[model samples]
Target: MTTHLIDKIAWIHLADGRVLSTRSHGRDRYYLPGGKREAGESDLDTLVREAKEELTVDLDPFTATFLGEFRAQADAHPDGIEVRMRCYESAYQGRIQASAEIAEVVWLTYADRHLTSPVDQIIFDHLHDQGRL
Candidate 1:
């Protein structure tokens, strides 16, 4: 078996034990709100840009903290494609509204893992075990 790596940054915004997730245009599953890093962009830079693009919010860099990294099959991609998600917990400004390529914005609890992608399920489990989701 072979695998292709797709690295992405994810933001975990928790409020009342739920995490913020997004459904991109034409996508069925929900995913953590963030995207891949661009050329010359730092992980933080990717996160900041993605959040603004997908959710219309401004992340506070000073309030950003590394949560952890997770890997799993990219369920929506081809068989060999895998995604490694680097997650961050952060505080942000403004209401979260779906924008750009995003179709919907949702807040999910641990039991809602079934609605997310495989990689996000891992994140959900990890956050659940830590009592943060």
Candidate 2:
């Protein structure tokens, strides 16, 4: 089985203690605002770039803090593939408008994470356990 490291960022917007999230261009489920890292890109770089592309907002890389990493059997892709997600916390600039690969941006709470990916369920569990939810 070939394992792929799906490096990603959480891009949490802590406004009134709520987290911002979004859905992919053609998907119905909601997801954290981020995406897979490109070649030669650092985690922070991926976060900033993906955020800008998907949300049309610039991320403060310096303000990005490592959150937690998550691993789960790939649900969206084929079976037997593991996806490793590296999450992060960052402060964003400008209004979040869905631009590139995103459909709609929404602020989510712990209760609203049920529609997230399988791997994200684990991340949400951890965040809840850490009292960050």
lDDT of each candidate versus the true structure: 0.91, 0.79
Mark the regions of model 2 whose C-alpha exceeds 4 Å error after superposition.
1-4
TM-score of each: 0.95, 0.88
Model 1 lowest lDDT segment of ten:
73-82
**Residue 16 alpha-carbon offset, candidate 1, angstroms:** 0.8
Best by lDDT: 1
Candidate number of the best TM-score: 1
**Model 1, runs deviating above 4 Å:** none
Question: For residues 18-48, what per-residue lDDT tens digits would candidate 1 score against the true structure?
Answer: 9888898888899999989889998899999
Lowest lDDT block of 10, candidate 2: 8-17
Q: Model 2: what TM-score? A: 0.88
Q: Pull out the clashing pairs in model 2.
A: none
TM-score for model 1?
A: 0.95
